[model samples]
Target: MVFSLKGKTAIVTGGGSGIGKAISTTFARQGAHVCILDFSTDNGNNTVSEIEKEGGSANFYQCDVSNQEQMETIFDEIAKNKTINILINNAGIAHVGNIENTNSEDLDRLFNVNIKGVYNGMKAAISHFKKHKSGVIVNMASIAASVGISDRFAYSMTKGAVLTMTYSVAKDYVNEGIRCNCISPARVHTPFVDGFIQNNYPDNQAEMFEKLSKTQPIGRMGKPEEIANLALYLCSDEASFITGSNFPIDGGFVTLNN
Candidate 1:
């Protein structure tokens, strides 16, 4: 029970699928009342149902993290009845292109979801945490933020901003019992990755998947549950001493990869 989140109310952005879904379910299993904020009501509701089936408490709120008004409205509603103790900024979109190939539109789209989305979530959660004098924020960054990766100009930029924002928020709110940190994972294996390969490499999805997996020095992509476990630990009371840190859960991609 060292990492117990009993009686805690946790909010996870993009909790419908991928890493977000994993974190949501994991947190719920740890006894937290989880609120999933996702754009896809179907997926979000599905996750909620699954949690309920497992005897865990959860609710789904349809939302787009990029829209400040929508986020503010939903966060306010959550705060009405529940004191939110944790926020996971895991909603983000992927873009594949270097600076020249990435047009202004692409950059703006990435900025809105990846960068501004984190900002919106943090901004909304900060007010609640400020009032309570305690909160934990776990942000999902990417190895792209620290290492130079080809064809990921915009993504790298946004994740880099996430890292800094984690630092700034943690430093600013540390005295108030608020802790902020980020996790950087390299190529997590999710449905999105499978779909990406199937759509882009219809004739050779398996081959492309293998190629992508080998890109990591560990010879395989990270798992969504693995990332979730890390997030759970970071958000728990056991991590009280942890803040303003960026944990790279990459499969040796940051160090061993040449």
Candidate 2:
């Protein structure tokens, strides 16, 4: 089977950096017109420029995925000019705190960005998919969705919600030719991890970095491009038979960590 996305259109939230950026670029490379949606206009534009430099089609959109008004407006505008065949809900925030340290505000912020953001994106895009009678939704979940992790109460909670959200959407739209799935990645080697190390362990950055890498059973973290490759397969025509599932891209973190 051929995995081709030529002539398709995709919207990737958080497409400005890390995993989202990799996914957006990969889709564009596979011949999909990608919309790089992010709260950071500069990063979004940079991603678009990179895609264009590689002779791939892409556009930048500054959007706060948690805001319903902003999301609705952007989706409306995109729908006017292009058919959105794929929606990748990837914008997320990581909160490094346990239940005792996580306050109401902390919990609310995670909920808004990680949970409601996915919800609003799907809700807005569902109408267009229903109209077209076919589409795919891929949510960015995490290993936290299926297993316990320390100091990740808020993050884990949000990802668990994401997993269920994918299932619900798939069930509701199965007959409509709309497929919904999710990817649960473990520690990925991204700038986010680098920044976290710099900010939290300025004195022993390298030591802490090694520690984080060993957390994955494979002795290292996964790469953004690896996750992006999995996403490309899932969103391609070859994956029409796959839906309502959460594919774990972790290096044995969820199943072999014991």
lDDT scores in order: 0.96, 0.95
In candidate 1, how many Å is residue 148 off?
Answer: 0.4
The TM-score values for the models, in the order shown, are 0.99, 0.99
Q: For residues 1-258, could you state the per-residue lDDT of candidate 2 as single tens digits?
A: 267899999999999999999999999999999998999999999999999999999999999999999999999999999999999999999999999999999999999999999999999999999998999999999999999999999999999999999999999999998999999999999999999999999999999999999999999999999999999999999998999999999999988977
Q: State how far residue 111 of model 1 sits from its true place (Å).
A: 0.6
Model 1 per-residue lDDT tens digits across residues 1-258: 878999999999999999999999999999999999999999999999999999999999999899999999999999999999999999999999998999999999999999999999999999999998999999999999998999999999999999999999999999998999999999999999998998899999889999999998889999999999999999998999999999999889899976
What is the alpha-carbon lDDT for the whole of candidate 1? 0.96
Q: Where does model 2 exceed 4 Å of error?
A: none
